[model samples]
Target: MNSTSKGDRLEDAFYHYLLDQQDRGELIFGAYPPENCRIYRKKAYYCREREADVEFDVVLELYRKGRDTPHLYVIFECKNHEASISEVYVNDFSSKIGRIFPHAVKGVMVVTSRLQAGAEKVARNARMGIVKYDEQGLEIIADRRGSCFEHSFVRSQIFRSANSAKSLKFSAYHDGEYFSSIDRFLGSLEPELVDGIRPENGGGSLPVPYLSIEQIKAAAGKILKFADYESGAVDLVKVCQSLSIDLQFADRAVLDADGVAILGSANFGRKAIEINSHSRETRERFTIAHEIGHFCLNHERYLRSETIIERDLFVTREKDGSFNYERLEYQANAFSAELLLPDAVFLKKTAHFRRDLEMRDRGHGYIFVDDQPGNSATYDELLSRLSTHFEVSKQAIEVKLKKSKMLTDQRKRNEASPISRVFAGLISSRKS
Candidate 1:
C-alpha cells in the first residue's frame, strides 16, 4: 500500500480500536460511558486563534453527567511512516493542539513506528502522549463482516507521558509501571472516572489467582463435564461452541505468538480466539485449550487484549522470582495440560500400555528412560502410542509423563560418564 493509504489504514484501525474499547466500557481516554463518549475521524474543529478549522486525525469527546455539550476533548494525530517520527512532527502537533484547545484537552501522537531521538523529550515538554501503533506480523484473514478487521492492540504501545523508556519490546507504561496491553495502561489512568472500572491492585500486573496443579485439573474436569466430553481427544471447537466463543484460524506470520484472544465486547459481538493457521495441529489444539483456560478462569475481567506467545505459554516465573503475567500463563498451561490429558484417563491408558509392554520401574518409583540405546526404542514406542492416542505432540506427552511422576529421564546422568569420572579423579590427585 502507498504511504498515504497505510497512514489512513492505521488511523482507521486505531479509531475502531477505541470504539471497541468504548463498547466494552473499558475506554480510559475519556473515562466516560459509551453513551456519553463520542469518537470521530478526520474531524475539523474551528480554532479561534487560527481563524480556520483545524483537522485532527481522530477525536474523542467526553461528556459529563447530564451534559448537552462535551466537557473534554481528546485529540489524536496518527502518523504512519517507514522511519521513526522526529521532534519536528511532535513539535508541530504540540503547537497545533496548544493553539486550538488551551485547557481540558489531551493530545496524543499515534505513530506506526518508533520515535526519533529527542522526540520523546519534546512530547514530554509539551505534555503530550505518544502511542506507537505497530501492526507488524499481523495479517487479517477475515474482517468483522467485511467492514472492520479484527485487529489486536496488544502489539501497540501506549505512553500516557513521553517520559518513559522507548522500548518496542514493552510499550504500555504509565507512572513508571509497565502494562501488557493498551487497554490495561489506559484503564489504569484516571481510574476514578468510572467506579470499579480499574483493575484490582491498581497496577499493570494482572491479579492472577494462585492455582495448584490439582486445582487446575479439577477445573478442567468440570469444563469437560460441562461440555459432555467423553472421548479420546478433547474437541476444543465444540467447547468454544458450547461457551459461545468464536474460534477462527488466520494466516499469522508472527513467530513469537501462536494465538490471540480478543476479549468479547458489544461492538465485536462476542469473545473470539484466533489461532495461527500455519501452526501444527497439535500446537493449534494446545493454543485453543490455553485460550479456553483463560475463559474458564474468568480472566476476561483483567484480560482486554491477550496475545499467547511461546513464553506466555510456558514461562511461569520472572528472572527476579516474581509472578506477574507469568502466573496467568502458568495457570493456563496447567489447565491446557489437564484438559487435553485427564488424570484418570491418562493413568489408566498408561497402565495398560505398561502392562502390554512389560515395562519395569527402575527403582525411581517410575519407569526410567535415558539416551541409552537399550531404552531408546521403548521410550519412543511409549511416546508414539500416547501422542497418537491423545492427538498431541510427543513433546507434550513426555512433559505430561514427567509431571505425573510416571516416568523419569536419566539423560543428564549420561553426561557423567566413566571418562568424566576418570578426569575428576585425576584432577583430585593433581590437587592433592
Candidate 2:
C-alpha cells in the first residue's frame, strides 16, 4: 500500500485498539485508568522547540478519578510501512508530546513495520514504548516504567487474533474483531467500579432544567427555520456540522451509541459525537440527534462535573430511585424528539388520523389511516409509517405526540398544569 494509506490504517488500528482497551478493564497506562481516559485521533499538538505544531496519530487524555479534570497525557504515533523507525524520529516525537502537554506525558510508538536495530533502545531511553503490529496482533517491544509496556509485550498480554490466539489468558479481545469484545469487558468493569463507589443521592444536586413540550418544539422550529427545511426532513449531519458539533459513526460492540465534548485546550483539538455503526440507519440518526442534544444542552459539562460517565450507561441512581442523570437524559431525549419530529412536519405527515371504532373508547379511537385496527397493531403501524417518514423510531414520534398534547389519554397522559400551559404558550408565541 502507499504511504498515506498505510499511515491512515495504522492510525485507525491503534486508535480503535486503544478504545477497545479502554472499553475493557485493561489499564491503558499506569496513571491513565481505562474508565477515565479520552482518546483523540490525528490530533495536533504545538511544539515549543520547533515553534510549529506536530500531529500525533492518537492522543489519549487520562482524567483524574471522580472528576472531569485531565490528569495525564499520552500520545501515540503509528507507521504502517516497513520503513525503520529511526532514533531521530523517536526523539522528535517524544519532544513534541512533552512540550505540547503541560502534564506528565507518555509517548508510544506503534508500527506495523519492525523497529530499526537501535530504535527500541533509543525509544526506551526516551521513556517511550514501541509496539509492533503483526498477524498475531500487537506486541510491545520496548518496556517503559510509566506504561503497562511489559504486560502488553508478552504473548499472553497481546490482543487476540480472531482466527486463533483465543487461548491467551489475559487477551480481552479477538484481533480482527476489536470492537465486539467491548460489551463483555465493560459489563465486568462496571460492577467493580459501582461496588467501589457509593451511588450519589442527588439531594443537593442542581436540578437539570426541564425541556417542556413547547420548549422542545420551539428548539426544533428554530433549527428547521434556520436550515430552511420546507421539506419533510432535515439533514441532521449537516445541521450538526453547522453547529460545530462533530457527528461520527463508530462500529462499537458494547455501546449502541455515545459522545463527548472537550473542554480543554483547543490545541488538543475538537471533540466528536460518535454514533454506533452497528445500529440501524434510523437508530443511528436518532442516536446522533440525542448526542447532539447533549452537546447543545451542555449536558457534558454537568456529567463531567461530578463523576465519569460510562459508555452507553448512566451514573448510579439516587436513593429515591431517581437517576443522577435523569434530568439530563430527559432533556436530551426531548431535544432529540423535537429535532427529528418538528411539530409542523410531524403534524402534517400524520394529519389524516382515522377513527378506530374497534377500540370503543373516544380518546383511544384515533389511528393513522391504513393502520391496523387493534391498539398494538395500529400504534405499531403508525410508528412504522412515522418512523419511515421522519426517519426516527415510532417511540420517538410517540413521545413527541404525547408531550405536545397531540396524543392524549386522561390517565396515562396528565393534563398540562397551569404553569406548564403558560410556559408552552410563551414558547409557542416566541417561535411564531
Q: After superposition, how far is residue 195 of candidate 1 from its true place, in Å?
A: 8.9
Residue-wise C-alpha lDDT for candidate 2, range 1-432, written one tens digit per residue: 788997887678667766766665454323346767788998876777879888888887767678776555666787665555676777777766777776566566765544555765666566565555432221111111111212222222222223211111122212111111222222222333323322112132234455565665677667667766765556887777677766555564421001131111100024466444433465556556656666667655443211112222221122233333444444554565568777666777676432322323354534322223455466556657777777765555665565556554333433454323322333332110
Candidate 1, residues 1-432, lDDT tens digits: the string is 898897799889889877866776656534466788799999998999879999999998878879898777878898887666889998888889888888877787877666765886787666566666544322211111121110122222332234321122224333333343344445444455634444322332333456666677789999998889876788888888888888887764553211233211110124777776534687777778888887777665444435565445434322233334545556666677788888788888888887777788768556778778778788778878888888887777776676677777777643433212322221222100
Candidate 1, residue 319: the lDDT equals 29
Q: Estimate TM-scores for all models.
A: 0.72, 0.39
Clashes of each: 0, 1
Q: Candidate 2, which segments miss by more than 4 Å at Cα? A: 1-213, 252-271, 303-323, 352-383, 398-432
Clashing residue pairs for model 2:
160-175
Local accuracy by lDDT, each model: 0.62, 0.49
Write down the RMSD of candidate 1 (Cα, Å). Answer: 9.9
Q: Stretches of candidate 1 above 4 Å error?
A: 21-37, 46-53, 62-71, 81-83, 99-104, 132-206, 252-269, 317-323, 362-365, 412-432
Q: How close to the true structure is residue 414 of candidate 2, measured as C-alpha lDDT? A: 36
